[model samples]
Target: MSYQVLARKWRPRKFAELVGQEHVVRALTNALDSGRMHHAYLFTGTRGVGKTTIARIFAKSLNCERGESADPCGECSVCTAVDAGRFVDLLEIDAASNTGVDDVREVIENAQYAPARGRFKVYLVDEVHMLSKPAFNALLKTLEEPPPHVKFLLATTDPQKLPVTVLSRCLRFNLKRLLPDQIAGQMRHILGAEHIEYEDAAIGELARAADGSLRDGLSLLDQAIAYGGGSLKADDVRAMLGSVERGQVFGVLDALAAGDGQALMAESTRIASFSPDFGSVLDDLAAALHRIQLIQLVPGYRPENHDGDDSALISLAERLAPEDVQLYYQIATTGRRDLSFAPDARTGFDMALLRMLAFRPSDGATPAASGGQRSAPSPQRSAPATPSAPAAAPVQQARPAPVPSHATPALATHAPAPAATPRVADAGGMPDWEALIQRADLRGPLGQLAQNSALRGREGNTLVLALQPTHMHLAVEPMVSQIADRLSEVMGEQIRLRFIGDSQGAAHTPAARAASARSAAQSAAEASIEGDPLVQALKREFGARVVPQSIKPFES
Candidate 1:
């Protein structure tokens, strides 16, 4: 006997054998058990996502020897015949090959007659969208009003091309692309039943490479098993697929976080040795950054089990700043898009990593400096303009670090006051939080969030903030962490944040205070304008009147 491929050998025989499609299965089960099944049905989805398979199973259920049921006894003659694809009543059609009016007309003509071997005749047309307009039109009336003995099951990868007249007459069930985990689980089940040993990581790599298609995954598995001499190994599978390990991607990030240029280049060179697709590598990096961001911004967010990537992701999430994570994510994705334009794949990848290091948020800007002393700039090898200074002369630091070329907004942040001389509270009260926010020069949405929140007081390591109930929704993950980080730097202590709704309905926030001050200034300016002696003289001499709307305030 010849060997059968895993995909064909392990094809789902019934609804229970299917995974990741409970919604469609439930609907079909109800329709069958309650005997309210529709005459014409359409199953639409991407390739290898069980569109035709579901249709076939539904056909088997309808004509099972045990009677009409969601579950059919496979031993019975009718069910066995359907499973064997030799059932006289179950007619499987491939519209891709026979897409003509004549073929559809033949089906329409045959659908009028009763089933030859079962209670109902099933017409399973795969890729129904391939049918020509004339064919679709010819079959419409029969499809919409097929005889009670006939059932039409249409499957297609593309349903948009189908005529709406035909679509409106059938019950449509859209199948979903299988997730990587779902694909991996099914792979594990098949490998166990086949008594084949496989590394969990290899299964994960195959599942990801499948790109949401179980059939594609199984095909890859077969190739991988043969490639590894009948055993699955992570390194072997990666070599076969030419994919970089997730650790190497994480290593690049770890280097980026530590601000180690040499280490970053070393990791890049190591990855380049594999001669893998640099674009896919950058995609993996971007995906890792996305997960890190979710961990950082989403409270109580659980990480997905992708062959033990959770712990490393969590570690990186804590090591890197939220702003830096977002910046890296953007650069990674755009870098992948612009890879073709670069001189070479490796160079493009190296530049992307180097960019992450170059435009770093805290290259020289620490949360708090000691003794108000900036880190001395590295010695320049270039000759000075005058060429009079000695090489041993101190490299004086007089200014903030020069902004990196092509730096993004995320890289610009407040350089907090020295930790040696932290800002202290006055009169046992909050240290004029509004003034502190201004002095620190917080920017962007984080600044606005701080301005809108009034400091209530502190309890232990946490600070209570009074915010309007309406604006409380703005106090989400990123904003909360950013504000806390900035404040802790200025206060010289780690502070957790807690927000409470301002029930008093009073304007106590910095924004409200600033608005009140502006209003007062405007009123004073308007009064001064109204009482001007020159204006009064002009009005009297020309019989003119001051325009109330034109009494502007000199606000700066």
Candidate 2:
């Protein structure tokens, strides 16, 4: 006689009707069928995940007039009344409202009596965690050992607040949140049954917006149906949810992969026209990047229709390096975090996109001058500073040639030499391992690996190095190959390298020698400061203490 909301109209009446909680359903089904029922049962989960729904269904199963079974017959008066929320024997209490000890005592007082009409007098308490400590204590005795005709069904979103004493007495069943696919499938089923016209993408948007709550999803569906004039379309749903269109998001990513700043900005302008939530747009970008990474790493993996154009993603994957994708994803997530702190949403998002382009790795080339001379600084290496420049310029200038930031120490050590450069050997003959490593271009992990390694010996073209056990993780295949290549290049001959892990093998590596030198210099500096006559006079006259940390060794 009255209009019913989808949540109410499609409420699950039987255990078989429940979704995404097969584990809990199976346990309850087996227990009920075996007639090995616990007097007290507790169901815990987030809201709209069917905790209260399962409790009501369990109550119906206990009191169904056809029989006390897992599947209750809807035709029976007891099942009908329970479903209608008017069953006298099934007392459904909102513990959120009746949370006092006196209210719990009243329920306890009523539990002493037999069932009014059904086989078992069921007491279903929703949000039971809302009950006070005294009320929970009051529920303990009755909950533990209720009358043979009584059944207690307790539901709560938060079970951590429940006392262990009460929890131990009850059989607890935890309901899990439904996944997006599960929610979407359920919506498709419902829409089909209702004879509603809908786009699958529209359903996907609603499902994602639900954030793992099916009831929330259904409520959103009800709102969507109304908003879309009884028909669901992707654009309408996207607009309603303030979600970015899949095409728009992928377009931004495609532009990013191409390193086209103009195209990316154009796409940003298009995305802005939708008045979409920029944070959500950034989230979509991050998610798409993650999928691209997965696709790249696992070639066998397939993308779904909801993930946007597969061909485009594959193209982007091939165009962009894995490291670049990772960097972009990191920047996007970081920007999303700082979006609120920025002046505006668009500014934050634009900056994040610009950062992605700015940090994109260049191919180590400089645009040639009109006369065909390459005067611009090459992307491969930093230019040497002029002697006339200020003091600060030399610090950056004198640093090692630029290499991929993500390059391992081994890679840094063996960076590619200029094509026109001629092979050079050590001034005299084969230098010692320490001297070779010092001349090696090795940077991060590669440098550390070399500095920690000692050349054991050489056999034919093969070089044997002892690697410390602590740094054995750095002795991977790429690092080993790079070291060998770099060594061969510098020695003006091909060479093979091998590493043996030894705990006490290398204590005199270049890194160790450098550390020893720094320590000696620091000690000398401290002694020099302590012995200074001006320092002694200040300490004696004014009791001015020398700050040990302030002493500098002036390392060469």
Candidate 3:
């Protein structure tokens, strides 16, 4: 007897034996038991996801000599014949080979006859979406209203290509892709029954490589068994699959977190010896980083993608900051995309790793490899000396922190516990407007309103604020009332407030003054970095260009 492949030998003979796809199985079983079967049935899903398999099982359920039940007795002639693919009443048609209208017409013409050896004649059309438009049109009416003695079982990977009219006539069952654990469990069952020696780890590798298809997983298992001389070993499977082991992947990540370039290159060399796909290596790196980030954020959160203790990932999460992990993941993904364009795979991979180290945020707040402690300039002195440029206009800004122009009006304020509230100064009995706004701790729409309004002196306990025409929309009653309330609380007096709307032309509001100050600081930071002697020397020697967007204002 010829040796049969594992996929074919272990083919599910009954719905109960089918792995995963419980949803499709349950619906079909209920339909069959109730004797409420539809005349036409459509099974759709991706390749090897059991679309055609379920169709055949349903056919057996309908024609089983044991008397039309969901569970067909294997001893019965009808069930056995269907299992062997030689049942006289089951017409298996490959729609891909015969997609013309003539073929559809022949199928329709044959519907008048009854089953030759069973209770119902079943027409199984595989890849039904391959049929031409005219072919579908010719069969639509007949498919919708087939003879009582016949049943149509149509299977397709691409249901979108089939006309909606054809789709509406059938009872559609979508089979879901099997998860890695499900496929691994099935592989273990087959190996145990076959009396083959195997490691659980080897089975896991095969399942992941299968990419959600049980048939593909079984086929890979067969090849792996043959390759391993009838015994599945983890090492042999990893070598045969040309995949990098998790240990090697973790080593690369360790080197990255330590900022050890030499260790990273050494690990890369060792991994390249297996001739593994560099792009896949990058993917592994990114996946590991993502898991590390999840662990860091959601304490005690373990992902199901990999098996066993991920203590290394947890350790890395503790060692590295969340921002660093995110930055590395982003760089790895971007590198994978650009790998094909590189001169070689190793070169691309190396550059991507290097870029991750090089492009870390300049802000001291973000952690670095040097023990998460970075030295930054004091807040008061961080902004560089601005170039002497003529001032645009005299804009008295009460608050230097600029709220964005498009920000919505916030009705109240809720400052965080650690935030320091600015002290309200008397300033010789004339309320320092900017200091007052900061002291009020106004946020949201109220913040934006105060940020954009100019302080026009107070008269008779009524402080009048001037608003530019562009900002008149924010001068609403609710926000104005909150501003007055906050001011009253801060100044220790119930000062009534009134707004002078749209009268001041091009007058600088507090937000505009803040924006101008920020622009100047950004310019000075960029100029200082660009003018550095070390930076100029590096640019001349290595042809390194500064990334402009990476430059942000620093406050000392």
Give TM per candidate: 0.63, 0.64, 0.65
The C-alpha stretches of model 1 lying farther than 4 A from their native spots are 97-105, 338-344, 355-556
lDDT of 3 by residue, 330-387 (tens): 7798789989999999899888877765545432222122442223222322131111
Error of 3 at 150 (Å): 3.2
lDDT tens digits, residue span 315-350, model 1: 666556666687688779868988999999888998
Query: Model 3 compared with the native: what TM-score?
Result: 0.65
What is the RMSD of candidate 2?
Answer: 17.9
**Runs off by more than 4 Å, candidate 2:** 97-105, 355-556
lDDT of 2 by residue, 268-304 (tens): 9999999988998898899889887876566467677
Pairing residues by index, what is the TM-score of model 2?
A: 0.64
lDDT score of residue 227 within candidate 3: 96
lDDT of each: 0.76, 0.75, 0.74
Query: Who is ahead in lDDT, 2 or 3?
Result: 2
C-alpha RMSD in Å of predicted model 1 compared with the true structure: 21.2
RMSD list, candidates in order: 21.2, 17.9, 15.8
